[model samples]
Target: METSPSLAGPFALGTFSSGAGPAFPGLVAGGRVLDLSAHAPTTRALLERWDDVLPLLREAAAAPAGEWRPVAELRVHAPVEPRQIFQSGANYRTHVIDLAVAHEPAGGRPAEQVRAEVAAMMDRRAAEDQPYVFIGLPSSVTGPYDDVVIPSWCTKPDWELELAAVIGRPAFRINPDKALEHVAAYTIANDVTAREVVFRRDMPEIGTDWLRAKNAPTFTPLGPYLVPAAFLDPGELRVTLKLNGEVMQDESTKDMIFGVARLVSYVSQTVELLPGDLVLTGSPAGNGLHHGRLLRDGDVMEGTITGLGTQRNRCRDER
Candidate 1:
């Protein structure tokens, strides 16, 4: 089906409203939102019937700008309420190498050699090993511009800006070659982490404790908009994050050792991926850990991914 000529370029999909009232699916264009509730009540509803709903959105976007609402007057939501969220860890080559070098500085070898060895290991993993995937609670998700509450009991809250892929269709054990076919769209996600809680010091044999380290209320700041996968070249996009207006994490998806298609297929090997499920490709290098700057109360984080839009979230201390 031919897309509406009016919706020519990369338009954003989201839910918005003038106040605290019910949110409606919207097509964002030129700082204005064209309500799509008449077509689909929620972004999840639109993704469920993505093929049919897309054409209608295009037509609606082509309509005259009479009913469009100024975005500044509206409240934006998390875009979609995902049923399941699959997150990738240690996916970016440089990010992992940095962590490795930081954790275990070379004893005799030059740092360059250590970096090279780690990179080689990543290459081997990409070729033979599976991607490390973790399940995240959907309850952790919040709107893009929402405030992040740093728990008082927690220290070393960190930021991991990642690219999230929203699944459009159901797939079970899909091959890597066809995995991207099921991706409906992409969004920006800040995978906030509690550094101190990542590992259980008392129970060394238990490995990672992602539940306490990652899943806190409003921990994942998702979406200023959802840019359809058809409109994005994930490999070409740059992911960047700024703390209090200073650049922290800034890198291109090109640096990822395992690409989106591979991550999706790798996870689908053990789990069924359904529509509205989010697959968060790992964060790029320059996380707070690398810079020696963890999140503090009252800090503001602004994250931007090329063509996907920007997200600004303030950090507040939990009461």
Candidate 2:
């Protein structure tokens, strides 16, 4: 059975609605949703003043249920529409090593040696090298339960379930030790990809083409709920994903080659992270590529990160 964060006392926040009504920022508690837009218009607005708004939200969540609606009656949207999204690549020790072994270079080296070398490189990188970061379009983000449209041209659509950190304060050139303080919340993000397009074949010198491979509309399914950073430990959570009732990815944040603090601080060195910016920590091992299975039309993905809710997205072909 799938287990999620306790929703007993209104600990998470989200954007939800009933029927065709507009989305509203809501407090999630005990399978019910309390609209919080009257207190703070949008999720971004509340995040801008996260420190101040948290107290107010807590008070409202504790108040007697007055306008609360059953969760089943609402449609959940991505909790926040970030101004910018920074995603980490090749940031999981085992995941990258798995890819390296699967696609061994022409060099005459044993597979075991390659794995050992790659693992050593990751250790050194964790201690010295900066995290590999890339940009993603906010327009690619869709609601947690939305459908993913696989473009007719894409033959290798893949799933990469990751933990995304939501920034609550502006951070620039901050050190790793202080980076976590700027994060207000954490949510689930599936970094869906077009495997065949990740690298530029014709322009190999230019390296990756992330924009084409990762930024398709509805490529990123974000947030059934946003759990506050203070409420959970980022490094200890377990991330699990199931495809049509079969487990595909099951790992822990403990396996991350570069943890959240390092990624956030490293990115802040180049980009100014705003209140609503998102930093997607890399996905763990057990992706479809390793399993030799790729997403197809009618496939359903259910991804869950401990303390954050699950995201269920059905894949469809773009006509």
Candidate 3:
């Protein structure tokens, strides 16, 4: 039996298209997909009317009396075309500590010493009550099962699987207590990175160059489906990723220094989050940097978060 967790709700939402047809919003339930093109058109439009559609979804899932098709018949896509992507960095305590310890110069200090220093620094960051968030272009996003093309210049390709919260309501400067109210659904996103170009060699003052380091075609592989926020809890979920069938990242959301609510609240203070915006909480422990095994050409990565579904992507060279 397939062991993947089912959607917490009776149905999930997705984008799909058949041969020679335009893509449409779909409601997935029990191996079947109900085309939602007539109701709200695209997935983004559906999310805009999420409050009204949510009740309709609950009612549809109870009986599924419409013209439902098998999920296997259509081509699945990265569920939503997000207008804005807010990515959190160093949000997970263990992931930060592990990276710091691994990247430390070998002869400089003991491994334990490096870990302790990093741990203390992370604690200070958490106590300060701010999250490090960055902006990402929507053009970098690709289908969940699509191929990731590792550019030739990227000698150190890495994977960071994260829990993505999709925004339903427009929010700006919202409090942490009200942040969850703006979240409509949850999905999966793999923030693939080219580690070498992350820091610019020419300019020390300019800091990170996210444009060249991260934004490449097919670098960000996103969701297979969107599970409603009402059905799942962002906290206490398990995030796991396997490379060539070997487990690399397996950790829980509990280790996050800044949970979903705090991260969302922090981001809203700076920008107005619109419908279909994505908030990507940082990855947990066990990334390629710590494993000492960067991605090779043709490598396959399968990532999963509890009740959100699994995303499997194959790597390809940009030749």
Candidate 4:
């Protein structure tokens, strides 16, 4: 039987992804350091005509040359710079649990108090049956290994590991069932937060606002690459987080209470989504601030997916 053309992975030609040793020379098989932003026009044309590029991506991943550059030498950029960056929060039960746990100690409240708050929110939401969601600005996104600025003013910055979808085409009022069709690919995102800034800027009477807390400058670090969804089984693939070389968050996409396609459909039903736009599906349970541990200077944060590859970032204090 002839192999299907879409049975392949995302492609970038460079000496990257090869572990240790000299990078494969010449244009390596994988563009570990792709220049997507450099050729925006060409990329838009390609996405519009993905069928033509599928075969090309297959050819590239199959063969690679030696003499690749150390990861530091490569120029990396955000995988997808859509018109907007949309995000949802607390879509997972694990995250909600962690939030309650994290806040209990700090809020100086008993565990029951935290549970009571969550229970009340859940009960009210159940009565109204509203799916909570919010927006994240595009300006917050930075490339893999990029610095997540620790603004001096913000005290409670945090990180959330999310599976984001890169839209393949313009989708407005699209049905949930057909949402997958509009997904161009999947990428990893670290939704950085400035907890203090968020509350101060957004909240009314000490209540938090989503924009200031979630959309701090250089708060979202993304990339490595937008892995074509076709290459991923969707059902499998472990999502893991490591801090300072120790595993902190380890979960799977399977844990997502609301899956990717459902999110795409839910948002598109109300908002007009454009090609290259991203939907940051909610994060898994384990997060530093969620556990009462905040990020400090000289810490390394790394995120890796089973098949999608890894994004390693070294944190530095913002000047």
Candidate 5:
């Protein structure tokens, strides 16, 4: 039996459709989906008018209305069609320290010293440095229940479950204090990666190839619902992921070296955040690399964030 995430609020939003039919925006309440295409064509469009539409959603959830359908009868997809995706790297304090120690030279330094130094450095960066952010392709995204194709060439596929903040209002050069004002909702995203291609072997100076390593088809499995930000606190959520029923990643969002507000403000300083854009906070500790166990064919990954809901994806070899 497939497990459904217990939503935190009275309702949430998603995109769904019956077979061969065009997808529509839906207001998900209990086990039913109220078709919302009449109000806004897509979830992105709904968010574009979030201020005007929020009250309507609340009323519908409270009383229930038009074009309702059972969730089991439809196909659920990624909640929003985001025009821009900004992903963070090395944002979690423990995840970065773990990586630093794991990659240290043989017999180079004591693990304790390495950990202490990394912790201090993270503290310093949090106080003085800006976030490390990168762009991701929207083509890489697949639905929450979709099959993730691990390309035959990808020997070390890994999973990075993260919390994704959905932008509702345009924000450029916003203050860190006011960054969250632009975020309308939050969802779950698994930022799947190809480990071997992460660094360019031939060219040493040029570091990290995010395009090749992370932007393959089905590399990002996103959403089951978009829980409104009013009902959830981005800083205090618990993020958990299971690989074939075994817990691999489980941590609190409090470990983030740079919080959501900081990341959003930092990205807005460079890129104009449009309605429907996504800002992905970095994943917590317990990645496959940390466990020395990369993804393989037949791996089933289930990821969940507090209130936002869950994403279940099965891995298959690329055809």
Candidate 6:
């Protein structure tokens, strides 16, 4: 499940391709990987200094796998044993409009209002490189094989392809310039949602405050592998999403509202980050489940992030 927390540790990963089979690639978990979400208390205690953990990950990667499960057979739990799960919203301008258009009642000035409102929402995101963050519970975590529930109220469930990071060590009041040192590695995140709850009458009047919509069980899908941060360039990576063999989201990391370092620094100031915590950076435009296009039983969702590899999960009923 790509559970290594320290950005400088060793780890194993699984990759999938359109023309390829299972790619069981391996790497040192922390030092090489740019993500730092896999921090554990024991690991944090071991490395008093941030840079010390990286070499340890390399050494551990070389160690024998006592009872390692193959990527095909194993179920992917959340990438981090996170102390807290943080997410960003309206990070992309087009995405804000795309979501707003999904909610308007067919066609009218209200629909146009929805579009303009979404445009305004996106403007807030572009105004600052710092991401708009939210929190999800550790209890909500699920593996890749688990079924994502289609809530009774939600006729429309959506998919958001996101780049998530795992923290490797303890960080508090850390400098933004030195933020890269605290990461563990990167992994693919599918931030599933129920659009009805996000913008519904029964729920709170607020539209963008998406706590329940984004916090459902199996709502966050992660893993396949935790690729070394050093293995791939984050700026050059592309994130792709497909539903039932149809292309939905095709965007790159370069479009992010906030890069990795700024996000870590911002979060560290408020909360003391622990190993194994997760941070979902945000998703690009072209979300289906949100646009009144919910997934039916037997549909499939697959995601491929640059160096981190691919994760393909089938959709099923909660029953």
Predicted model with the maximum lDDT: 5
lDDT winner, 3 or 6: 3
> What digit string (tens of lDDT, one per residue) describes model 2 on residues 179-241?
999999999999999988988989999988999999999999998888888888999999999
Model 2 TM-score, all chains together: 0.95
Report the number of clashing residue pairs per model: 0, 0, 0, 13, 0, 39
User: What's model 2's overall lDDT?
Assistant: 0.88
Model 4, residue 42: what's the lDDT?
Answer: 40
- What lDDT does model 6 reach? 0.63
Worst 10 residues of 6 by lDDT: 16-25
User: Can you write out model 4's per-residue Cα lDDT over 85-175, one digit (the tens) per residue?
Assistant: 8887766666776676665545587877777787677566545545567888888877676677887777777777777787877788887
For candidate 1, what is the lDDT? 0.86
C-alpha lDDT of residue 113 in model 1: 76
lDDT of 1 by residue, 90-147 (tens): 9999999887676564476677777999999898988886788899999999998889
lDDT, residue 108, model 4 = 86
Give the candidates in order of lDDT, highest first.
5, 3, 2, 1, 4, 6
**Considering summed lDDT, which 10 consecutive residues are worst modelled in model 4?**
1-10
By summed lDDT, the worst window of 10 consecutive residues in model 2 runs over 1-10
lDDT of each: 0.86, 0.88, 0.90, 0.66, 0.91, 0.63
lDDT of 3 by residue, 68-142 (tens): 988778888899999999999988999999988887776988989989999999999988997899998899999
